[model samples]
Target chain A: MNAMTMIELGIAIIILIGTIVGFLSAIGFLRLPDVYNRAHALSKSATLGVLCVLVGTFLVFLFVEGYFSIKLFLGIFFVFLTSPVSSHVICRAAYRSHVSLAEISVRDDLKEAIIENNKETEDM
Target chain B: MAIQVLANLLIGLLWVFFQDDWSVLTFFSGYLFGLLVIFILRRFLPTKFYLFNLHAMIKLLFLFIVEIVVSSFVVIGIIIRPKMNIKPGIFSMETTLKGDIEVTLLALLITLTPGSVVVEISQDNKIFYIHTMDIPDLSNSVLQSKDRFENAIKKVTR
Candidate 1:
């Protein structure tokens, strides 16, 4: 009985942490200055949050129920692998599509590099 | 990698037999146990296809998780504040890693961390264009990121 309660408590704490992370990610998504910043929030926090939730779910199924889920483990691994890739793709696409940077952005190092490369090419 | 997978699967099957429970957890535990066994015996294993150092890979994973938690808190702190005092910028950094997989994994690690996203890769793949949320000191930030993430990745992948 005590062991079961301890397991339940552990599950609850894990789920709670996951929920808090998801909440923070949502807040970041709504409050950040631009798409890039929002993308950061969405990618990092949401991915971690989802991972935590999945971990909690995994524990629940393992401890509360007597079944183990290969699918859940696969889902967790897949999400961990793919979420960052998707975010990188989106950010690159946004940059190529000429999405404007936030007003406080102080540097465009890529622009300068591109200009230098172009100049060198012309010299050739 | 194929050999590693096969060995792990065999270990997992053995674990299930021992546990007397044909469940995923038992199998997974067995797989992990197999990995540990392999890690221990890596020095003696006469395989030419050892792709990575197991200890370094584990360290990298631990570092990544720690960075995620810390950065998440930092971002959260910034978001909940009344004034959004951010200085975002795109910066280029030179990388010593050359392989496609290494570069891609490095980029993914950077993107997944807080306050930075990989914007582009140079034609020669020698440089990475990264967009960072805060750049109080450009050189410092670059060096910190390189030390923290890039170095570990290089150890694991290269």
Candidate 2:
């Protein structure tokens, strides 16, 4: 058996936990009732999962191999930045396209705001 | 802004590559040197040096990490229940944050917190329309979270 250091064990555990988080997010995405709800699972939880995996591996390379992968750091930053923006854009587009909310949704205060904006545009 | 910071980092990373040095200390020293070099040549540069509110930036990052971890577990709890009883809905909240950067950052932070996603920002950029997965109170909860985020952002921008 190969000798394992504490750092290696920690990295392995983190990656494994990330995998589990990603799996749970996938389940949440599929099980959620509407597009808006699924976007939550995808944007935030999955991003967390990916963040954990990338940071864990980055640490392994940084500590064990003594290789500084700046690209890996960029990957983390870009993923954190882009995922939320993409998900936000998708949600905005869906709402603008007149997608109806699920029947169980308690309220949609945005509808009133959108109607008011439309009325202002008509006046202009 | 992109060219300025990216150029500095690229120079530092290049130093690491050329010397076959993977040490972070080496990279940082090189980065500092690049910063000095850039500062010396700032007169010729187009954009001014990037100003950072380091205190507020660190605070925002800390809040983001805490929110991400806590809300993710909360979401998982909602999903794990045998019966997925929820009050998924969209609500609008007005924010004091102005400018593209502050507004965008606030929206990004809100979405990254797991339970809520920003569906839209109004034309004036003062109001945000958000879709929450399991939030029960629309107005009060929004105000609470909004105050937390808005304060962090106000520090950073102004």
Candidate 3:
């Protein structure tokens, strides 16, 4: 195959990998027994998958027009920075409101912490 | 000190190459100005004697890049999917890293990686509360989260 075709193949592989990971993450969202467990699957794996796709796009851009690759990197940087924080906030909210977990859950440090924190607040 | 001056001179020359303008006086003044800034900063904030080992920093940067790309697709997929397809909730990740800066960097990495965002850091800072967009296997996700990102931070920062 030619060089361009090789690049295309690489990009396609990346996109495919990303797509599959995304699908799995979504499935994890549905299949996981509880919010905490689901969060585990969705955030970490999906992040990995999306990054693969972005790298593919970056590669394509680098080959075709080299101008915007840095900007693309910056965009990727912001996504890396923010996604985890927002997820944390959402989950904390759920826990504070007393969301139920799956039956198999053995330990819950967050619940404990929340309880301890509440007691401290009440004492104060 | 002399090495830093030489390095700055080389950087200034490289800049001139990019700009395609070779003005000796301008380069000299720019170099002086850059040195002045560094000097002022150093005066205010004393330089550490610790050697600048970049191996960890480079590794962290590489891992973070990979994470950003992956999480972007994940988030986008969640947005576009037909179903209200997300199992959103908080989970705490156990960590091995102990340094405050290291933990903060790990937290930053977690947040930057998309679908997951940091919520609360325990007072001890050994545990991180994170929210995820979906779920499949919590244990695997927890392991992967540490292996891929948090563990990498520990290796680098420590």
Candidate 4:
């Protein structure tokens, strides 16, 4: 009973931490200036937040119920795999649609690449 | 190619769960069972089974987890600060990686690892346009980190 309680406590702490991280990521989304900045907060940090929560849930199912939740494991796996792709496509589409970076931001090497790409394609 | 391996792993994992034990014996037996299943279904699969190097894949996964944790803290610190002093920009990086699976994995690793997310890939997939949140020598930092990830990925795919 004592060991189970301890395990439950640990799981609760993990879930709590994940909620905090997710909250922070949301705040970051609202505070950031543009698409790129928002993507940074949403992609990696949010993924981490979800990961912690999913892991906590998985642990709970394993230890408390004495049952393995393959669905939860698959959830963790697919989220980790797709989060980056989702963020990558969003940012790519925004950039391709001529979304300008915020005034406070500096550096844009992609512009040159786009120019060169267009030139190469036109020549073909 | 990677799908077959993932399917096998899923089958193996399912076996462990079905048996309700987390022992190595259970997993290996499950893996053998999955192999038989795959053998019977080989005619239906688009890709053939290949030798999967577990050590390299584990190393890559470990590297990814470590990088994600470290970078998560870094970004969290930046977010919680009073002032958001960030110089976000998109930068192009050239890569030596080839093939669809390798390039895709590398891109995913880059997005997950550092302060960089892949904004775009060139038509030929030889170049990547990366967007990063800071400007205090982050491009080089990203390149160095990406090189580590690339080496790890090559061990698995190539």
- Candidate 1's residue-wise lDDT over B1-158, tens digit each? 45766887898899899999987678889988888887787777665333366787789778767766776776677777888878888878888887786788778767756678888898899988988788775335555777567678777765
Residues B52-73, candidate 4: write the lDDT tens digits. Answer: 4568889988887888877777
For residues A7-75, what per-residue lDDT tens digits would candidate 3 score against the true structure?
Answer: 888888988998887787787677666765556565566666666688778888987665457667876
Instruction: Please tell me which predicted candidate would have the highest DockQ against the true structure.
Output: 4
**Reference-based lDDT, each prediction:** 0.79, 0.83, 0.65, 0.86
Model 2 bad stretches (over 4 Å): A1-4, B1-31, B37-52, B137-139
The CA root-mean-square deviation of candidate 3, after full C-alpha superposition on the true structure, stands at 7.7
Q: What lDDT is reached at residue B91 by model 1?
A: 79
Model 4 chain B is weakest, by summed lDDT over 10 consecutive residues, at B45-54
Candidate 4, residues A87-123: lDDT per residue as tens digits?
Answer: 9999989998999999987888889878987898899
Q: Could you tell me the lDDT of residue B90 within candidate 1?
A: 84
Ranking by TM-score: 4, 2, 1, 3
Error of 2 at A93 (Å): 1.1
Clash pairs, model 4 backbone: none
Q: Which scores greater on lDDT, model 2 or model 4?
A: 4
- What interface-residue Cα RMSD does candidate 2 give after superposition? 1.0
**What is candidate 3's lDDT per residue for B43-157, written digit by digit as tens?**
4544321123357668778777776666655555555566554445556778877777778787777765656666678877777866555444433454576766766665554
Sort order, lDDT high to low: 4, 2, 1, 3
Candidate 3 residue runs with Cα over 4 Å from true position: A66-68, B1-36, B39-43, B47-54, B63-100, B108-119, B124-158
Q: In candidate 1, how many Å is residue B134 off?
A: 1.2
**How do the candidates rank by DockQ, highest first?**
4, 2, 1, 3
